[model samples]
Target chain A: MDIILSNSSDQPFYQQIKSQIKQAILRGTLREGELLPSIRNLANELQVSVLTIRRVYSELESEGFISSHTGRGTFVSTIDSELIRESMRHLVEQDLQKVIQDAKAYDISQAEIIDMIRVLFEEDL
Target chain B: MSTVLTVKQLQKSFGSFELHDISFDIPKGCITGLIGVDGSGKSTLIKCLISLIRRDSGQVEFWGMSIDDAEQEIKNRVGLVMEGNNFYDNLTLHETKELIENAYPNWNEMIFQKYWGCRDYHYSSRTLLSSLSQKEKLIFSISLALAHNTDLLILDEPFCGFDPVDCSEILVMLREYIQDENHSILISSPSGMEISSIVDSFIMLDDGELVFHMDKDHLLESHMLIKGATSLLGNIPVSEFIKLDIGNYGFTGICNDYNKIKPYCADLDLTVERTNIADIMMAYMWRRGNVI
Candidate 1:
């Protein structure tokens, strides 16, 4: 999997790693059951400490993005459609709430906000 | 974690200088920083690690297998970038990458592109190493090292001669590489000011001998710069110090217990400052009379 880090960015190192792996999975760049480079190999390749890498892997594993087998190495987990849809729906709802809150704070009516969003979609199209 | 590299009683002598009784394990997936002065044998230890130079006496194991038995396999898994541009001057950046790619079994092109973009190394693959600027040369070398995707990256002064932007970019790349948990880095550089904060642990060498091997936090907490009048120096017990340097204004030393000495120093009206890695290294070297 391709990963990049930004030291100057506010994001922690592990989060950068997690997001990259997550993006790869979402983009289908990393296939289910594709074995990742071992933690030591990744650490050495990246010239970083193992502890940092271990934390990333543990985080990924805990999130069900990857699974590790004893002596076998880590692999991207099989995609669970239901889980993915549920997570995506939750995220969209949260984002929608933020949009509504922003609209209210700006003194924009719901109909105006909806009209603006429709115009944005038309521009994109 | 499995042991990637181990050295026991590793003794290497270069005329007057020798790395004595150096024993350490580079646990799998850990970045181990070898910190020392120019002549303190950091390079010698790295050379020994790669078997570029023969050691007088020592045992080395790579991946739990003896180095003697698995030299080729071990070398295959170990990526090394020493001081200077080790690549051929005539070869283009692309040529260098091709050469390394052919040698290593696990070279990854996608990761190479990502690191290249992250480092902002914009040279075309065909750009000759001879034509590149010094900073470009360093970035190219780093890219080639990461592209190979080795189990361990042994870098000597990887950040030398780069501007702040380039240095920061390289640090980001290094952090990303270690995120995979299978990689580890062993880097030695005289300019530890920038990268010390990110390093996991430090191994300090003095006069070709291992002086200190400890985590960064412990080193910062344990060592101190004790400043007091020259007369107060005699009153302070010598047993509390690991090494001491007496200056005209005051003295600085590596103390075993900072708390124990704090009260005595307070009574003596002396000032104490917590030591940083650089200061501790300087004082330690000064005590050893290695600094000139």
Candidate 2:
């Protein structure tokens, strides 16, 4: 997987790493139980401090997105789809909220917004 | 957290040039970069660290043991890549390894072979050092450093003239080595940005004086650069900025106290920009030189 870090991001370096890995897990780009690159290796690849990678690993472990075995290295944690579905739905809700806000600002009614969503869903098929 | 090497109040003089109170620590398992222009006492500090030149006064500690107490033992474990790639000009790859093997008790032929032949370096055992490419010479020097059971690898611009691929190879190898808990590296280069991604932290030496020392990530977070009219700076305190470049059109300055200045920026005719290590180094090096 390609993990690109941008200097322009306001997020702290470690936080950026955590979010990327979490997104990967949620999207299934990183499979359950798949071995992750060693922390030092990732740190070296990203040109970041080892401590930063360590912080990312620890935070990911705490959130159940990843797991680590001493000396054996880190791996993506096996996750329940119910939790991932909830996360994915929340993400969709955020996008829908933005669209609804914009539509309301344009004086579009709730019925019109619902009809637009229906049309968009049909277009996807 | 354990310090592998540290210099405290290190002072040395050579009639015309002097190193004044140079001090810092290289922690175990961390890569600490030294940055300064040439002749900025970087080589002198490395020599002092290895005790090649005697210091007038100050303490040099190796793994928490006094230098005098462990100098000989320490020499065996500290690997050095000094100027000139210093291998005998006509010696073959094997011949050079044979030479380094005598000085280091832990020198392993197997270790040398791993980095040597397996890393895309195809060579005849009789191939002379002078015949190898510049990149090849650097790899050879580092292979010796790695093979000798060296705990601390000290590099001084060994990759200066190397190609991008070779430089990245060197960085990757060093990081891989440091992944082993007992190894650490202290590397120095005139251009800090070249190794910013590779180094865990850095110490900047300016004309023989320690100017800045910090972890790389924190360095990025602690400061920001803003480009705008020079008149804007007149309203801000001079001390607010660590470096500046002023010109006819405007000025671009790095402010360490970025958070404090953020509120004031909203009303100013300027844009605050995210910065990288290279930009930071340039501003510091040219902080007060020719304007703009």
Candidate 3:
């Protein structure tokens, strides 16, 4: 699914895979109930250990982003629209928290922080 | 995830050295590095894998079928590059490519062209193999091997003639080749120091015996090179060691439990250093005697 690994990244390889899959699902690139490649296939495609891919799939499944059916294959789990929105909001809040912490650490004024947020929000938009 | 290659009690006897009761798994899509020093039965074991030489007594399986039964299927999937350029001396690079292209069903002409394009290696498909430099010959062989689209690439000392830049380039290519994960590589090389970083696991042979078959990380974690006063060596517990070598400076060894050895060494006021792969190999080969 066009996922690439960064050896220098703080996130482990499996986490990188999980995060990319989640992003793909959120972006509608990976449709709900779409079958994902088997652990072995994915591992082979990514040139990583099957154990690494297994960890990624397990974590994604546990997080309710995917589901696995024995012999059928792993598929992107269907999520309620409300739940998807809530999860996306939570992710954004977590990112905002980091920004707030950085702002405080930098001794930025509330106005400066607001201005920075506005610029970032506009750029993202 | 089926076993592509399995060797059960595989024994191969040379004039002076013999591989004794060798057994291992080469799982589908996994690159297993066959590591050993010169004349340590790496070549002998590979010959047995390829069925070039007769094994004393053992089972060899390739792709769910016995090696003897499925010779053609195994040969189709397997691509081998040994030390020397075994190509016809009179054949140019182009002729060599055409020859190998006709042999393998899955040969990719575009991929072959791309490989040549990526490197500054300009040899006339017509340039005779004898005219090419050693490095060029090795590169040509590798290019041809990769073009075969074999599921398994068994490379024996493919890096022999490569300089650092060329070696790195080859490593990059190998890394990309294994992207299919279904494609596995069984590489036997004395130059373990170069490829060890890229390999998934190591199969170390010593004195015609399987010394270790485990992940590279685990081997590094398990072994240590403890150096201290020669008197402190005796003070440390010897039972925990697999092998030990007393050097002029101090001593180094492969220990089963590094934690246990660390405490014992600490008690004796000795420092334990993290052992390199070469040191661990040397310790096992020399059986605790001075290797260097």
lDDT of 1 by residue, A1-125 (tens): 67876643434456677777777877788998999987756655554544667778998888788999987989999879886676567657868898998898789999998899899999999
Q: Which residue window of length 10 is worst by lDDT in model 2 chain B?
A: B283-292
lDDT of 1 at A60: 82
1 or 2: which has the higher DockQ? 2
TM-score, each model?
0.66, 0.81, 0.69
Q: Which digits, one per residue and each the tens of the lDDT, describe model 3 over residues B60-145?
A: 98887888898878887888888776899987767777899999888887767666656535654556889877766776787788
Quantify all predictions' global Cα lDDT against the true fold: 0.76, 0.81, 0.76
Of 1 and 3, the candidate ranking higher by DockQ? 1
DockQ score, prediction 2: 0.55
Q: iRMS of each prediction in angstroms?
A: 7.3, 1.4, 5.8
For model 3, state the Cα shift of residue A7 in Å: 15
Q: Top model by DockQ, which number?
A: 2
TM-score rank order:
2, 3, 1
Segments in model 2 whose C-alpha atoms lie over 4 Å from true places: A26-35, A61-68, A75-125, B119-125, B230-238, B263-269, B276-278, B285-292
Quick one: best TM-score, which candidate? 2
- Per-model C-alpha RMSD: 13.3, 4.3, 8.9
| Local accuracy of candidate 2 as per-residue lDDT tens digits, A1-125 | 67888777756688788778888889889999999998767888888987788888998898777889987889998887887887779778978998998997799999999998899999999
Which has the better DockQ: candidate 2, or candidate 3?
2
DockQ of each: 0.09, 0.55, 0.07
